[model samples]
Target: MSQFKIRGGKPLKGDIVPQGAKNEALQVICATLLTPEPVTISNLPDIVDVRKLIDLLAALGVKITPHSPNEYTFQADTIDIDYLYTDDFRRRGAALRGSVMIVGPLLARFGKGYIPKPGGDKIGRRRLDTHFDGFIKLGARLRGNPGENFYGVETHSPLQGTYMLLEEASVTGTANILMAAVLARGTTTIYHAACEPYIQQLCRMLNSMGARITGIGSNLLTIEGVTSLHGTTHRCLPDMIEVGSFIGLAAITGSDITIRNAGVPYLGQIPSVFRKLGITLHIIGDDIHIPPHDHYEIDTFMDGSIMTISDAPWPGFTPDLLSIVLVTATQARGSVLIHQKMFESRLFFVDKLIDMGAQIILCDPHRATVIGLDRRQPLRPATMSSPDIRAGVSLLIAALSADGTSIIQNIEQIDRGYQNIEHRLRLLGADIERIP
Candidate 1:
């Protein structure tokens, strides 16, 4: 295991080009199994999760060739579908939550698919019931052993598209059902579908591969099943979550940083949400430039009351950035409520912030009220451990901008998302080192 030892209180300044979206890359890679032709993907973030997914794909007999660095061509012409029953498949597949998505394509192409319970962050209870419900709605029968934590699906007939409303806006669940719906016999009308950028990218990629899909950015999606899908080249979009992380990093550390190649259109409600926190972004071409500033003030509600920033479905502030926003709010002047409505346990990380001397009220498992210090007293650094991906990065941000040296363990969680995070921060003048 490795840990990061950071010396805080230095302003990070430089240019950072965001990596390709990890969520989009995961879905796109799985889409390769829909066809036997070569599907090439470029600008993929070289993160641990992506690499693990690649390993899982290779195990399934997908021929993944590296055309160049950060680019690969995936061919599933000789897939070993039986590998899904192996112990290796179950262990590795359960490592990341996104691994559950492989079931859709595998079941669609082959007649059977098997998967263990998927694992990722422990932020809240992520139910796979909706995914199973979607599969059942499409004519697949599922049987699982509760003691073994293993699941299996088998279907002899082709999946029949039907009208179904998702219980909640589950991102991976939407992608799984979307993939399955593409090869079904009829039109699949999905209401309450997750229309996040990753899901939209998956839909667009499927359309590019000859699957007819409409309602790209809406809660309701219509997908027309095609006989077969052909492979094509698709580039993954820039990770807006990472872009938001950089924005928070710049503001809290009082740095001037430029994030290049950021997909501005995909950053729905992000810029405006941060602007309410008094963080300014200068748009120059495709780059978002954040200038240096010592103090930031929180914007109040229209009634001249304390403001609140919360997460919702697409076109709303992203839940992924709530942790970053909480850390940024600690350095701003005034008070704001950070409401994370999606996940119940996400607010538990505020205890670490309180340990650093920031004023925070942990109202419940889903909400937190932050009163910014306005740089009055430097946050006292302490030893900490990363709990999850987003919370891990938020802790790193707090540590980097704190008063003294801090050590953060369990950095593998951070590696699963961010690409070369320590090196990137080092380039931006942050005193961070990785110790093994």
Candidate 2:
């Protein structure tokens, strides 16, 4: 496995630019199969997951042309559906989580779709029931058993629209069913749908392509089925997860960094949540400026109890950044409780940080209590392994602020979500390099 060798205890300064949103790109790229015309997409992030999805599209005979490094035009005029049954297709499709999205557009236009059981990060139990359940509700017949290696969804006739109350607000599940519903015979109503900004952007793009969708930023979504859709252009927003990671990096490393074109308006509660950690940041136009600090503090609740930071749906702090927050709080002036409600095992990475001298108590699988060191004793670096994307970057942040050189293994997890991370960090005066 590739590892990162980082010399710690040095501040990083300069401007950094986050790439386009990875989640949104996965959704919209699959939407291209809804029409035969060319769909031009710009601001696409070049990461492992995104590349895997694009490769899947190409394998299905979607003609892809690159206009620039971050822009592409896709035309799915002719698709080789038979390829889905091949070994190559099954092996490639199961490599990334986003592969399931292709089923929606295929079933919408071609009346069938097939995929192997998909794979992704091993954070915890991630169920695909939400996805297939929505498809079955839309009058499509499922073609395989629950635990089978390969499954399929097909409809003999055009799908009929109906109302569905999602069990949970799953982003990919909603995107999948929404794509299928747009071509149904009548109106479809979805309650408790995911309303994240990326989902909202997908709705806007669909609307521009002639789909009748209402409730752009709310949980309730209404879609009037259209017979067909046309081509359109879409530019993805900057990744908020990356922005939050950078903010955490600045907080722990005592650095002054300016993040350009951060799309601050869509970053709901992220800035305020960091502010609660006593990290000073200024919003100038669309850029975020975090100044160098000697030390930071954690704010308590209004009743003066220990502040509890948790994750909820949109308009609430994202669970993706909780790892960043937990790592940032290592050297803060006070204590806080981090509740990771959605995923059980995300907080497990704290054991590695504790080895580096952060005072953290794992209350359970879902909660961690952090007592900040207040910079009284700097962390002593040691070798560690990255478990996932967020946790990997969080460890990188800790290593940068620690007193000695540190080694991180299995960084392919980091590259799955981040692009040229070591190169980018080096540009900001960070002492980080990749080693074989």
Candidate 3:
């Protein structure tokens, strides 16, 4: 267990490149299982969750070759499908939630896939029924041992394409279903699908590998199954959540920083939402530049109601960045409501921010009302524990702007998402150090 000891009130400067999208890397890396040919992925984020998935793939006998620090060529020419039944497999598969993504490709290519109940952030009720429901729709049977938490998705025969109206626009659910549909016979239509850039990238990558998919960027997706898929190179986009986090960091700490290669086109509503918080940012081609600001004001509704920033599906603000937004609001002018609709308990971190002298009202498990200090009251540093990945970094951002030294334990949560976060922030002049 490592912790971050950070001395606050130091403004970070210089350009920092965001890591390749962790969510996209998870999807694309899992897609590698759909093909036996060499699939090279570039701009892979060197984060814990991503690395865990790579290791799981290797454990399943995927040939992995590292070309550079953030690039890998995966060849799943021969997979030991029986490995899914091992006790070691159960333990490894349960380590990270991304482990569940492997089941889709395995079920489509081979006839069976087994996964233990996945482990991840304890944000809220994140159900796997959507994933298993999609698998069942694709002509697979879902099985579970009476006493074990393990799940088995088996396809005794060829998967036939069918129409599936996803219960929710779950990103991982859509990715899993899409992977299976690619090798399925005939055509498949998915309504209410997740059309996030992550899903779009996965769709495009699968297309390059010979799967026919259309209606990207929309809730309706059509996939024409191909008997087999070849391998291709795919480069992940810059993590938009990291970009948003950096923006909030700049605002909270009054820092001047430039995010390199931010993939501006793919950052839907992120910049505009930050702008609503009165943060000044400029789009420089593919990069985002955030200038130092001593004070920023939260915008209210046009009809004179309190400003409410809520998480929604694609094209709306991402739930992953809501934690960042909440922390940034602590120093902004005026009040705003942070609604974490998709998950409960995410707003529980507000207590830590409140302890740092931010005025916050935890209305419930899903909502928080923040009355910004407008920088008049500096946040007092305090020791805290990281609950999850997003909230962990949000707390880190708060620590960067607070007045004294703060220690954040369970930094492994932060490492699960951000790649070399301490080193990256250090380059920007942040007074942060990791303590084991």
Candidate 4:
């Protein structure tokens, strides 16, 4: 395994262009299975997760031809459905949560699909019930052994659209059902759907491939099932979560960094959320610029009370950035409540920060109150292990700004999403090294 040895107390300064959204790219690649023609995708992030998904697709006989480093054309015309049932694909498919999306398209096209338990961050109980529920609504019957970590789905006939009020606004669930609904016999109305920018991009890509979808940016989505779909070229959106991560890194490390190609339209509540934690950002055209500051103070309410930052469904503050915000708040001058309402275990990482001289009150599994020291007391660096993708980046930021050298293990978790993170940090003047 490789580790990152970072010497802190350095201000990072440079320009960084964020990679394509890994979340969106996964779903878009799976959408290729819905058609027989070639679907070209551009601006693809050369990350571990994307490469794994592409390998899974190639194993299933999806012809993939690389036109460039970050571009590829995938043709599912010659797919061998049986390849998905093999042990190798099943084991590899479980490596990422995005792989679960293949079940919907596979079932829709081949009348059957099999998948092992999907794997991802161990944040909390990420159930696949919502995904299966969508499939059942689309005329699929699912069955699997209780103790077994596999699922099997078979459809008696072509699916007919039905209205479904999703129990939760699960992003992958929405993507799964959206793909299944595209080939259904009738119109499907999905209430309480996830309307995040990534989901909206999936809908737009599906539309370009001859699927009719309305309510692109809302919780209620109406998908008119089509008999078939063709091929199209799609450019993945710039990753907003990475943008937020970089923003937090620049602030905590006292760096002046500019993030290029950041989608300004999708960063609706992000800047304001950081602003509450005393992080100021400037949007120069399509780029977000974060300048260096010696001391940052958290903003309080008009009633002269502490402010709180939390996550909700789409258009609300993203849950993915809560860890980043919590880490950034450690250097700010006031107290703020960081509530991670979506996951139970996400707040556990704060304990590591507290050990490094941060004043954090772990209210519960879902909430924590952070009192910023305003960079007064230096944090003593220590050995740390990455827990998840977002938390891993947060810890890296903390390590980069700490007083001494620190080692972070399990960097593969960070590589799953962020592309060339060390290289990007180097460009920003961070003294981070990758050690094998």
> Which residues of candidate 1, in runs, are more than 4 Å off?
none
Residue-by-residue lDDT tens digits, candidate 3, 1-436: 9999999988889999999999999999999999899999999999999999999999999999999879999999989998988998999899999888888899999978889988989898788889899889999998997368899899889998999999999999999989989999999999999999999999999999999999988999999999999989999999999999999999999999999999999999999999989999989999889999989999999898999999999988899999999999999999999999999878888889888999999999999999999999899999999999999999999999998999999999999999999999999999999999
> In candidate 3, residue 290 scores what lDDT?
96
Superposed Cα deviation of residue 23, candidate 4 (Å): 0.8
TM agreement with the true structure for every prediction: 0.98, 0.99, 0.99, 0.98
Q: What are the candidates' C-alpha RMSDs?
A: 1.0, 0.9, 0.8, 1.0
Q: Indicate the residue-level lDDT of 339 in model 1.
A: 94
Residue-pair clash count for candidate 4 = 0
lDDT of all predictions? 0.91, 0.93, 0.93, 0.90
Instruction: Give the per-residue lDDT of model 2 (tens digit) for 1-436.
Output: 8999999898999999999998899999999999999999999998999989999999999999989868999999989989888999989999998999999999999999988888887778777778888888899998987667788899999988999999999999899999999999898999999999999999999999999999889999999999999999999999999999999999899999999999999999999999999999999999999999899999998899999999998878899999999999999999999999999989999999999999999999999999999999999998999998899999999999999999999999999899889999999999999998
Give, for candidate 2, the lowest lDDT window spanning 10 residues: 120-129
167, model 4: CA deviation in Å? 0.6
| Cα deviation of 416, candidate 4, in Å | 0.8
Clashes of each: 0, 0, 0, 0
For model 3, the superposed segments whose C-alpha errors exceed 4 Å read none
Order of candidate numbers by lDDT, starting with the best: 3, 2, 1, 4
